[model samples]
Target: MRVGVLTGGGDCPGLNAVIRAVTKSLIGQGQCEVMGIEDGFQGLMEASPRVRELTWDQVSGILHRGGTILGTSNSANPLRDDATKALVSRNAKALGLDVLVVIGGDGTMSLAHGLADVGLHCVGVPKTIDNDIAHCERSFGFDTAVATVTDALHRIESTANSHHRVMIVETMGRHAGWIALEAGLAGGADIIVLPEIDYDIAAIALRCRERELRQRYTIICIGEGAKESGASLTVRERVEGSPDPVRLGGVAHVLRERLQPHLKSEVRATVLGHLQRGGDPTPFDRVLATRFGHRAAQLVLAREWGRMVTLQHGEIGSVALGDVANAQRTVPLDHELITTALDIGISLGR
Candidate 1:
């Protein structure tokens, strides 16, 4: 069997671990030929076969590495574009792949489903910093993203306190607050903001001032899509057909400006951005990615194509690709846990 693999969407920690695990596991089966498809679906959009060889030595020393060995992309959806479809079909036939493994988030999985719908064999492994994958209990990069934010919050807290400033740390969670919520609570954020809650600039500023008066400093954790009441944070700033819609400046900047007046002194915003997705993945992510990789490969071996490896009830597992097609798992607006922010005197900007 000839297997082709690629990473898509934004880079994340544990990506290389997945690649390493998948390559090593598949290579052990002497009959299998493994190919690295560079730059997500774009690889298939480019090369005659859109695939290249993966020797054992090339996979070495990348277990603890970040990013991907085969590279990644934010473009190429055959189902969405005629050009992409032509490019992909041309490459797939030339490559002669029995199966293709796609590792990434919702957009990437959606692409995988498209290929499968077109009669291509494909398997998916969920990867998202947001941890918002539908039906999957967790995704590979979520743990690492949370830990990275927590660490940043820890460090930012001290600086904010010493300088008597309000530190607003913006994290990536386009439609969910998992990253902000978990990391905020873990790192003593006085207030945690989420896209699920409509925020009030005045309320957030007041919270910071209140914390400033009481503790001499304030730490605010805000999700990228978090908004002021009746207002949006990031607007679409890129091409419509693109999976990763370029975002305008995020809420952290606006909130930081609003918060400055309330602060007794200095105020700043730290956008975690790609830093949260880089470097050595936390142990949890490495383990999870390895588990997902192992399961994904097993699924391919079993001809369980079109099923995405999902995390269920704390276990690595699989789900039908169609189950997640066009679906988004967002933070529930009425979650009691979210309501608890009010109980603790942390405003949700309501």
Candidate 2:
């Protein structure tokens, strides 16, 4: 079989592990030819992509690496234009690829589903630090992102205590609050804010006052998408033609500004931005990515096209690509984590 693989959307820590696993697994079969597709679906639109043959030697030693060898792009969507879609089809046929493995989050998975409709054998491997992909309990990079944020919070907590200040740590979570929630819980944050729940600024201010009375510094973990009751804060205007136009940010600063007047302590906000997306994958992510990649190769070998590998209830499984296309798996309001946070008196800004 002639197999092609690509990674798309925002680069994450465990991407290289997936690429390595796919390449090594397919090559181990000895009857398959693997081609690395460059820059996501954009590579498919190229008249001649920078496709390269994959071998054991080339994929070795990449398990600990961050980012992807095949590259990625967020704005490359074949469905936006008929000509581009045709070009993708032509390129795939020209390369004689029997199967294509797409490793990405929601946007990229949606693209893979579209490609499958056009008769290209496509399989998806879920990849997201946000852990927001539908049908998957947890994405590979979520653990690493949470760990990174937790470590950052620990450092911030020390400084907050020393200066008797209110430190607001911003984490990445556009539509979901898994990162902020998990890291906040694990990092021992006094307050946790999420996009899923609108925050009561006045209530948060009151909490800070109470903490100040106890002579304890406050540490708040806020998701980038966290919002006020009826207001939204953004760091910048959305690009007109960008795929991800809702660039949520500045919520931490907004919170800091609003809460400063109500608190006696110094208030500051720190945005972790892309730091959560960088660095080496955690051990859990490495193993999960490897499992997802190996499962993808096995699916292709079995000709089970239009499926995406997922992890649920401590088991690796597969789901139809159509089931998760353009779907988001958000943190449920009744989740145990939320209950735990509330039980411990952490303000969710609700």
lDDT score for residue 60 of model 1: 73
Model 2: CA > 4 A from native: 233-237
Candidates in order have lDDT scores of: 0.82, 0.90
Instruction: Report backbone clashes per prediction.
Output: 1, 0
lDDT of 2 by residue, 1-59 (tens): 89999998899989999999988888886468899999888888777766888788899
**Deviation of model 2 at 54, angstroms:** 1.3
Q: Write the per-residue lDDT of candidate 1 for residues 240-295, one digit (tens) a residue.
A: 66776666436788888877876566789988888888888888899999988888
* Clashing residue pairs in candidate 1 (N, C-alpha, C atoms within 3 angstroms): 199-229
lDDT at residue 240 of model 1 (Cα atoms): 65
Q: TM-score each candidate.
A: 0.93, 0.97
